[model samples]
Target: MTIVDVPGSKSITARALFLAAAAEGTTTLVRPLLSDDTEGFAEGLLALGYRVERRPDRWLVQGSPTGPAAREARVYCRDGATTARFLPALAAAGRGDFRFDASAQMRRRPVAPLTRALRGLGVEVRHLEAEGHHPLGITADGIEGGELTLDAGESSQYLTALLMLGPLTRQGLRITVTRLVSAPYVEITLAMMRAFGVEVERRDSPEGEVFDVPPGGYRATTYAIEPDASTASYFFAAAALMGHEVTVAGLGRGALQGDLRFVEVLERMGARVRVTDEATTVAGTGTLDGLTVNMRDVSDTMPTLAALAPFASGPVRIEDVANTRVKECDRLEACAENLRRMGVPVRTGPDWIEIDPAAPGPAEIATHGDHRMVMSFAVASLRTPGVTFDDPGCVRKTFPGFHEAFAALREQWQGLAARR
Candidate 1:
């Protein structure tokens, strides 16, 4: 059996790197995603005057007083949600005019929540073309972080965008989110905020939860990103569906990523999960039992669960994830539609979806040009042969070698089948 340390948490690494880029001095990122998202983010920083060193393993980012930058530049962040959402506010905070644009997918992606939030905080951000979308012309401006409510129903990036900007505001930002989905991502935001230097407090009341982020900038420090739990998820789900033992390395107990809680979801679904300081192990039970789960907090794991659902005995229902409508794609619909195409009994609605395992049939899968879709279906291929993807390279957005890894695993499975 081959052991693989799961890819580094792209979510955590990107968030940490963005925060580190704004700190006072040079910071060393121990393990960051060397993918397109981070590269785009670093390019954005470079355009805004931060010195970035792209190394073999780690990235060294030199931070300075972001008043005047190298030059006024335009940043095309591609389709990376993190770079698209986080860089705009940082560009504005640096008080330099920036023309921020993105790929067609990113153009369609919602940014109005963030622009509205920025406008409320007193930044002069205007859309060049679409009313609430990207292609923003941001004049160097700083806002007094004030109390405001954000409609983060689409994606948690809206909340995270503000969280990163709150501490940098002239006045600390007190934020109250309306229908804040992906609460774990917000928790990840808070954890990263606390790690860097922002002391944000959350209090519970009858009205809702309130966050008080003090007015300050992040502090530069040596930071390490945890292994990507979301990437490890497909492996774990494969083990559960195929009864193979899978161990994901480099994940720590105190990992800043809330997606790490995905191991808990696997456990509840009947996979035996063990967590150590260095790694997480999911021992396959050969077959997973169906689960009726609310994945609002861990929505990134939804596809993995859907892939594993066909192996379960009963119907699996995923709830509280309506926000999946605006992820890299309409993940809920995309996932459900794929499963239905596979002849699995699947039901979907505005916020929830149900998948009941049935006699598997032939289905040509559509990735919808989303990375997560590509990886989740790779897990399904182990159980059902003749399954191919529309765009396999989509995994490069997170893990580039995903299909290759699955191919290696399939070879061994084929060898075993030949002997049988």
Candidate 2:
């Protein structure tokens, strides 16, 4: 059996940084992802006067329970949306004048929903340049938390930021989510918060969904991050494409990331999947079935599914993924455009895409600076020889060693084919 060791979860790493920084003692993160996004998150914490020791294996963070030591600071989030969204809320927990800026790509992503929610909590938030975009400035005397409502239709990060900040608020926080997308990510946030010794009260009400967070801060402890299931999807997709077995270690049936549900889609496409306590394996049956899948909750894997769709026996229709349009790039359009470039016929609507199976030809896929695009199209390379990428290095956002890993897997697959 061939096993791939993927990096730790970016989501969990970012959340751990936030929770550890806000906790009252020292916390150690075991085997956290060391990628651009996570590095940006750690940098943001450092800017707030939190001490983070980066080691060869683990990260040690000294908690700042009373919030940031520096009253005024500037945090540059680069292209990390999680850092861009979550750090501002963390800044609001402190009494400071803080400015948040991001890379050109992240500046285009929306932050107004989170800003509005912060305003409702009596924190003054201003966009230094654009109205709803990045380059934001916040003047905070700590969150005067109260009842607030926000729409999370554009991105779930807004709700996650608010939920992470809930425990630090003076009056606690009562959040009514008007429109929630990627609901599973909020579950991840709540679950991690609980692990950090904070419990968020959740209930479904007539006025949408309500989360009541009491005013009790987090408790610091040693936390181990799970492998990124989203990154593992690429290896699984490769298995489906080449009729081989690909196992991703450290992500299993009980993984915290909702993207682990992506294996269900692979199973629906006629792939055999075994998820145990330690690892998840995907074995292909030499054929794939096309089906309609709604990937709203686990949208990160939509690109992987799109890459695999062209090789399936029938058409694959992916629906409820409009939120993908607002990600690092217009991912839905990027996927459709790249698939068309690869000679696959793709039809798209505002919230759905249908891909028809066709003979894929070699094409240099434009990655649009989105990491998912770079990684997804790499799976297509296993079947098509001439599959290349315009910006393959964009995968450094989440998986810096992705190309090397993919190459190693290809060599292993070829060796197995020769032995057979």
Candidate 3:
């Protein structure tokens, strides 16, 4: 059996940085993802006067128990949405003045929901340029941490940021989630918080879901990150498309990422899946039956599923992923446009997309500067020649060596074909 060891999880890596920085002592993160987004997150922590030691195999972070050492600092989040959203909440826990900015692309994303929630929690946040976007000024004397209501329909990161700050609040924190999407990601946040020695009480209510976070801080500890399940989706999709077997090591049945559920989607579409303690394997059956899938909980793999749709025996309908529109690009529109470029028939709605199987020809796929778009569409290149990307390097956001890894997969596939 051949196994591919993918890089560590981006989501977990970002969360580890935030948790480690807020902990009381030194925390070591093992096998973290070293990419543009995660690096941006680490840099943001360093700017707040947190000490981070970067080693080839691990990262050591010396956290400030009271708060950030820097009373006032400016942090540039670059294109990392997690950094842009989570860091401000981390800043709120400290007695300091912070000015947060981001890249031009990140400036277009939404941060107002989180900012509004912060203001309700006694943090002073001002939007410098736009009302609901980045380039904000924040002045916080530490989180008061009382009951607050938040609308998390736009992005679950808002809820996650607030939840992470719950244990740091003066009065503890009770959050009423008005509109929640991507509940699984919140599960990840809760899980990580518990790992850091904080417990959040959760219950389902008529208003929505309620969380009670006790007044305490995180304890520093050693944590190991799992391989990225979202990035592994492309290779899994490759197996489904080309009737090959691909196994991603370091991601097992116990993986924390919700995107690992993507393999279940492939299974429902007639692909074979085997998940063990060591690794998860996806083997194609040379036949794909299109099916309707709701991707609300695992929306990150929407593009990978869309790429595999064209090779299916029937149409694939993906629903409950309107949030994809708010990602790095309007992913729904980008997927539609790219499918049209490849001569595939596609129908789209506000929160759903139906892709009909067709013989896609050679075409240049526009990536819209989204890393997932580039990696997802690259899978189509395996079965259809002349498939190219507009900006392949945009994959540096998460997987800097994506093109090289993809080439290795192709070589492996060719070797398998020669054996056949």
lDDT of 3 at 75: 98
Off by over 4 Å in 2: none
Per-prediction backbone clash count: 3, 0, 0
- The estimated TM-scores of all candidates read 0.94, 0.99, 0.99
lDDT of 3 at 190: 90
lDDT tens digits, residue span 1-420, model 2: 679999999999999999999898999999999999999999899998889999978999998766789899999999999999999998899898999999999999889899888887788999999899999999989877889888998888999998888888777889898798888888889989999999888888888899999887889999999999899999998998799998888887678899999999999999999999989999999999999999999999999999999999999999999999999999999999999998899999999999999999999999989999989989988888898888988999999999999899999989989999
* RMSD in Å for model 1: 2.0
Predicted candidate 1 versus true structure: per-residue lDDT over 301-415, tens digit per residue: 8888887788787888999888778888899999988988888889998889999877666677898878999888888877777788888787888887777777776676568
Write candidate 3's Cα lDDT for 1-420 as tens digits: 457768999999999999999898999999999999999999999999999999998999999756788999999999999999999999988988999999999999999899988888778899999998999999989877899989998889999998888877888899999888888888889999999999999888989889999887999999999999999999998988888888998888788888999999999988899999978999999999999999998989999989889999999999999999999999988998999899999999999999999999999999988999999999988988999998989999999999999899899889988998
CA RMSD, predictions in order: 2.0, 0.8, 0.9
lDDT of each: 0.80, 0.91, 0.91
The deviation in Å at residue 351 for candidate 2 is: 0.5
